[model samples]
Each structure stands twice: as structure tokens, then as C-alpha cells.
Target: MLTTDSNKATEIRQAAAKHHGLPLLPRPTDDERDPLRWPRSLKLAALIATAFVNFTANFAGAGLSVASPVLQAQFHKTPNQVNSLLTFNFLLLGVGNLFWVPLGVKFGKRASLLISTLILFAVLVWTAKETAFAGLLAARCLSGFASAAGESIVPSIVTDIFFLHEHAAMMSWYTILVSSATAIGPLVASFIVQYSRGGWVDYVWVCAALAGANTVAIYFLYPESNFNRPKEPLHRVSVTGEDADKVQVVKTETISRHRVSVVSKSWFSIWTSVFTINREINILEVALRPLKMLLRPSVLLATFIYGTSLASQIILIFAFPSLLLAPPYLFSSSQVGLMQIAAIIGFSIGCFAGGYIADIITAVVIRRQTGNVYPEQRLVALIPGCLVAPAGCILIAFACSDKLHWVAIAFGFGMVSFGTIYAPNIAITYVVECYPRVVAECLVAINVFKNLVAFLFLYTAVDWVASSGWTQVYMIMFMLVSLSMLLAIPFYFFGPKWRGQVDISNVSEE
Candidate 1:
């Protein structure tokens, strides 16, 4: 009996060691035993708050576009100069990622969100009230900075609060909210400008009101999600006299320890939580880590893929209005805004196709491969989008060159929108799965590269298309999109091998 007992003890220790030492995998805590025990109502509320934040911020970004003509008249600037508002906004949006994610990682996600939302509300007010062109431009720059939390910080919150099986689906919902704003903002802006005596400022007022309401909701509903997982192994001997021989590691009550209970906190306590600062942050390290992510091969590849897709989207946003408003199409401002409805539908399709399908692929691949889910599993979903997106570009080019019916152009736009959401969603999901330790930093790097590329292309997009005509410019864009998509072929084939080279054991403590 003693010899058998000794052997059993050895086996248990080995099992514990196996779990504790795996760096790529999250350390198993009580939270893993029953993942469904997370507070359903609070989780739903939090998810809604984050989604609203994403919508409000993105709405502000797109809202300015429909009013470009009015802006040009008021500011006495050329079309190019007017578009620079977005240039500044996109540039800072990327740069702001570096700042905001680190703040969330250090200070706390809820606190960072509240602060960012307040800043966004203030900037929108300033944008609405400012009469000078320079003041308006400055407000836009600041608004981009303020709104960075939605893109960089909110996704991390999603990852922090949800399970692996849930990440893709939840992310899809988040993306839907963000993408809908592009279409919805223009609709709101066009109608508000059309009817309101307040004119262009009415759009800003609406955004500000939505943002202010969201800010209040976040303050009351959003709780901190950055719970530090206990390092101790969960398979310890039970202290109960009746169950001395048994291990009770999977109890739902034990899992509750991993969450911070705030249902009972008073108003003052909730308000004061925002002022709490984390002392563990090394400012220099936080600033440099995202830049360092660029050196990782997998990260770099993902960056390029996401960046190319983003640049294409920005190009389409700027170019489509100019194209439709001129010559054969002659679409009104309201009509052009309505055109985004097709893209909105496409994005909705892409979100469901790419996001949930990704989770299914991971499960299928893992089942096929002896129940092991590799990082490369995420790459399979990219192929469908990769092939389809460029086809959309081709369709758009031909339709524009020949002046086909508006529906042809709309269909092409839909395809591009679908691919944009589908491919980038897979890329980001793969990165997080592969490098769970440094998600915040890796995302910051991705955002930086994506925004920089967007700014460069957007600044010159109008001029290039005007000079070369729609067909030629779009053909060139098609080639660029194709090349970026082709780059993924290598990643799909060799991604597992490349991920194997990464020492995920040296994971970020943050």
C-alpha cells in the first residue's frame, strides 16, 4: 500500500510540473476548471459598453468624411488639405495605441477606458464648437489620440475577460460595432447636415452626446478585468477531513477568487478607482516593447497583411466619394453615404465568416492533430478572404473604367469590405493565440504599422487616382493587395515551424 501511494504522489507532481512549465499555454488556475462560471450579466454589460465605445469613436472618425465639402468651404482649403484632417487623425490613432495599451496594462483596463472616453467627449465638444480651421484640425488630432482606447485597449479587455473558445465570436461582435460606424456615421452626418440649422456642427453634437452617454455607462458598468492568476498549482490536497485523499481543484467557488467582485462597491469607491495608478510599470520598457515587436517575423508578417487591408479600406473611403460625386454617377452626399450600406453588409458577413469560422477551424484542426491546436490553424481561414478581396478590387476597377451600373461598383465594394474584415481578423486572432503573453504590445505594434500605412496612402490617394484615372489607380491597388495576400501563402505553409522557433516561455509578466 505504501509503495503504491508513493508512485501516485510522483505522478501527481509530474502532472503539476507539466502544466506549470508550459509557457505558450496559460497557467491552469481555478478559472479553467469551470469557465462558464463568469458572471453572465456583468459580462454582457461590459461587452456592450466596450462595443458602444468602439462605435462612438469610429463614428467620430467617419463622421468628418461626409462633411468634407462643408469643411473645405469653411476652412478655405483644397480637397487634399481637407483630407489631411483624417491624415492627422489616423496618424495619431496609431501613435496613441502605444500610449493607451501600456496605460491599460499598468493602471487597469476600466480606469484607462474611462479616462480615454472623457477625453474623447471633450475633444468632440471642442470640435463642434471651434470656428477656426486650425482649431478644428487640432481637435481632430486630439480626438484620434483620445479614441485609441477603443481599438487598442478594448480588444485586450475582450481577451482578458473571455475564454479561448469565446475570443473569436466576441471579437466578431466587437468588429461589427466598429465597422457599422463607418456606414452609420455617414448616414447620421448627411441627414443631420441636411436638416439641422446648426449645419456641420450638428454631426459633432450628435457624436458628442453619444460619447458622453457611453462615458457614463462605462464608469458605472465597466469593472477591472486584470486579475492576476495565482501561481500556485490547483491540484493540492484538500483540507476537509472527509476528503483528505481527494483533490477539489475544479470548484466554481475557487474560481471566483480569480475575479474582483465589485457588485457591492459604493459610488465613491467606484469613482476613486479611476485615480489608482499601478506602480509596477517601467515607463521606458513599456514605450520600447511595441517597437521591439516589429523585429518578430510572425508579428511583422501579420502587420503587413493588416496594414495593406487597412490602406485599401482608407483608399476606398476617400476615392469612392470623389468618384461617385463626379461625371457619370453624380451621387449626392446623402446618396454616397448610403452607398456605404453595401460595405456595411459585407463587413457583417465577413465578421461572422472569419471570426466564428476561425474558432471552428481551430477545433477541427486540433481534433485532427491529436487534440493539439497550433498557431497555424488560424491561417487556413485567411485563404478564402485572400483570394476573394483582390477579385473585388478587379471588379471595382473594371466597373469604374467602363462606368458600369452603380450596383456593380457596390458589389465590388462589398467584396473588398468582406475580405478586409475576414483576413485581418484571422491575422490578429493568430497573433494573440501565438503570443498570449504580450498581446497588448504586439497589438500596439500592429496598429502603429497599420495606421502609418493608412496615412501615407490616404494622403496621396486622391491625387494619384485623379492623375491616373480610376481604372489604372485601382489596378495598381489590386496588384498591391494581391502581393500582400500572396505573402500569407508562405506563412500558412511554414507558420507552425516559425512559431516553434519562438520561445514563448519567456512570456511578458504584464
Candidate 2:
């Protein structure tokens, strides 16, 4: 039988080890032993929240073409100058994750979310009041910064709340919300601007209004999902002091004992029943994680593959309408916005189902690979999308090259929308699944790299399309899209093996 004193000593040593940060894995508990499935209501709520957040974040980016002139007229700037708002948003959104993700570990997901959501609301409200060009720019920059906290950690939130099986589809739904907003936000912005003499300001104010409304809704419904409880030592022992030697060991045990004692001693709980201690200072490590993730080979390669593709996607959305509508095409701005409906229809359902398809591929791959689910499983979803996007680019390119039937152009656009949305959804799912612990890191790095590329291409996209005509510009698109698809195979096949090679921190803690 274990004596009371030896049992207490064992407990002390275990606590010390945890404080020193040498955790093996998240221990399974009766509460957590609940089968790895989400409650139906909770799952639906998460999906809805993710979709809503995505839509709001993308509200302006989706229809910048329509909003561009309103901005140009108000600020007396060129199209490139107008598009800079998004460039700022992307930079802040990418880097803000670095700041907010750490909060998830220290304060838990709900509190972190509340803080971010509130800040987003306040910034948007303040943005609505800015009238001068510089004022508007400053407001937007801060709004973008405030918005980052929510956007950066959402994938982590999804992972925290949902199980493995639901991830692909849930992520897809989130993507759908994002893509749809891009497809629809401008359409809405255009109509709103047309009616309101205030024009571009109306669009910003409306978005601000929406953000404010969402803040209240989020606070009540969001659940705590840190999942990790404060660890306490509960070591098993014999009545004799035999295990005493284990705790007394100079090198390892000494380190462990000091750590646990420090943390345990520092812990001052409101009640003995408290199972969580706030580790506030360690938060800086969390904030800088996404920056460190770029050093990882998997994140770097995957970011290149996915980031460039996304940059192209954004460039197409922002630049293509003006190219097609402005002179010889002679289509009105409204007609251009209408053209997006074809793409929007495809992007919405295409994204939702793409997740299910990714899940299916992962399941099939798992069965074939001795019941193991690999990061590569997520890549299979890209296969069809990858091939389809290039083909769409070819058809669209050829059609634009010839100024062929508008119907031909629309058909190709439909395919492009479907293919583009699907492939990235796959990439997002793969990254989240592969680096579940450091998910916040991978997500933000990809966005930063993606947006940086987007900022660069956006500058040249107008000039390139203007000088070369749509067909040649699209030929480049076909090549880029085709290459992206072809590259998916080896990554999906070889990526799994590599994902296993990296040491992801905090999975053991989760």
C-alpha cells in the first residue's frame, strides 16, 4: 500500500514536471472520453459562426471593383490606391493571428473571441465616422488590425470545437461563406451605393453596423474550448520510500520538482475545485508562433503552393471585371457585377461539398493505410479542382482571346469559380488537420505570404491585362492553375510522410 507521505511526494514531483513544460500528451479523462463527435446543435452553431465571421471579413474584398470608383470619386485616388485598403487588411489579418492565438492558450477560446469581436465592432464603428481620405485609411488600418484576432484563430476554434470527421466539411462551409462574400459583397455594395448618395461610405457603414451586431450575438453563444485543464500531480506509489529515489534524482527530477513547485505555488485559486491556472506570461510565445512556423518546410512549401494560387484568385476578382467591362467590352459596371453571380453560385455549393469530398478522400485513404489519417488525405480534394481550374482557364483564355460568345466566357468563369474555391478549401483543411496544435501558426503565415504576393500582383494586374488583352493574361492563368493542380499529387502522396516528421508543439497539451 502507498503511504500518505510517499503518495504526496509523488504528487509533488508530477506537478513539478508539468510546470517545467515537459508534458507527454493530453491525458484522456472521463469528461473528454465522450466519443470524438460534436453535439449536433454545437456543430451547427460553430458552422454558422464560422460562416458569419468569414462573410463579414470578406464583405469589402468581394466587390471592390464596384466600390472602386466610389472610392476614387471620394478620395480622388486611382484603382490601385483604392485597393490598398485590402492590402492593409490582409497584412493586419495575417499578423494579428500572431497576437490573438496566444490568448486562446492563456484565457481560453471564448474569452479570446469576446475580446476580438468587441474590438472589431469598435473599430468598424470608428471607421464609419472618418470622412477624410487619410482618416478613412487610418480607420481601415486599425479596423483591419482589430479584425485580425478573430480571423487568425478561427481555424483553431473550429478544431477545438469539432472532431476529425467534421473538420473538412465545417472548414468548407467556412470557405463557402468567405467565397460567397467575395462573390456577393460587391453586388450588395454596388446596390447600396447606387441608392445612397454617400456611396462608398454607405458600404463601410453598413459593414460596421453588421460587425457591431455580431459582437453581441457572439458573446452569449461562444463556448469555452481550451480543453486543457490545470494539471495536478496524482502519482501512484508504494508505501515504502523506494520511489523516493525517483523524485530525488539530481538531474531530471530536480528540474521537474522546481518547475511544478513554482507553478503550483504561484497558483492561487478561488476554490480548491479550480482546475485551471492562468499562465499569462507565456502568451508572448503564442503570439510569435505563426512567425516561427514559416521556418517549417511543410508550411513553407504548402504556403507557396496555396499562397500564390490565392493571390491569383484575389487578383482575378479585383482586376478582371474592370478589364472586361471598361472599354471594348463596354459592359456596364452592373453587368460586370452580375457576371459574378455565375461564379458565386458555383463557389457556394462547390465549397460546401468540397469538404465532404475531402472527408471522403481522407476516409478512403485511411482505410488503405492501416487506419491512419494523413495530411495528404486532404490533398486529394484538390485533384479534381486543380485539373478543372486549369481547364477553365484554358477555355476562358481561348474565349477571351477570340472575344468569342459571352456564353462561352460565362461557362469558363463558372468552372474557374468552382475549381478555385475547392482547391484552397482542401489546402486549408490539410493544414489545420496536420498541425492541429500550431494551426494558428500555419494559418497566419499562409495568409501573410499570400497577401504579400497579392499586394505585388495587384499592382501589375491592371497594367498587364490592359496591355496584353484578356486572352494572353488568362493564358498565364491557365499555366499557373495547371501547375498548381499537378503539384498536388506528390504533396498529397509525400506530404503525409513529412507531416509526421515535424515536432508540433502543444498537441500533447491539447
Q: Best candidate, TM-score-wise? A: 1
Model 1: per-residue lDDT, tens digit, 1-510? 999866654454444322221111232344532212346576777788877887887788877787788888888999999998878887887888888887887787787788898999999999989999888889999998988887866666667666555567677777677766766787678777767889779888888999899889988877766655443221222121333233221222232233333333334644556644657666567767788777776778778777777676667777777888888999888888888888888888889888877766654444344334556667776765677778888898889778899999889888888877787777787777766667778888988888887788888988988888778877877887788778777887787676654332234421
Whole-model Cα lDDT per candidate? 0.72, 0.62
In terms of lDDT, the best-performing candidate is 1
- Model 1 alpha-carbon miss at residue 508, Å: 4.6
Candidate 2 colliding pairs: 16-260, 62-182, 63-186
Name the runs in model 1 displaced over 4 angstroms: 1-28, 31-37, 230-272, 500-510
TM-score of each: 0.84, 0.78
Question: Candidate 2 at residue 112, lDDT?
Answer: 63
Model 1 scores worst on lDDT over the 10 consecutive residues at 232-241
lDDT of 1: 0.72
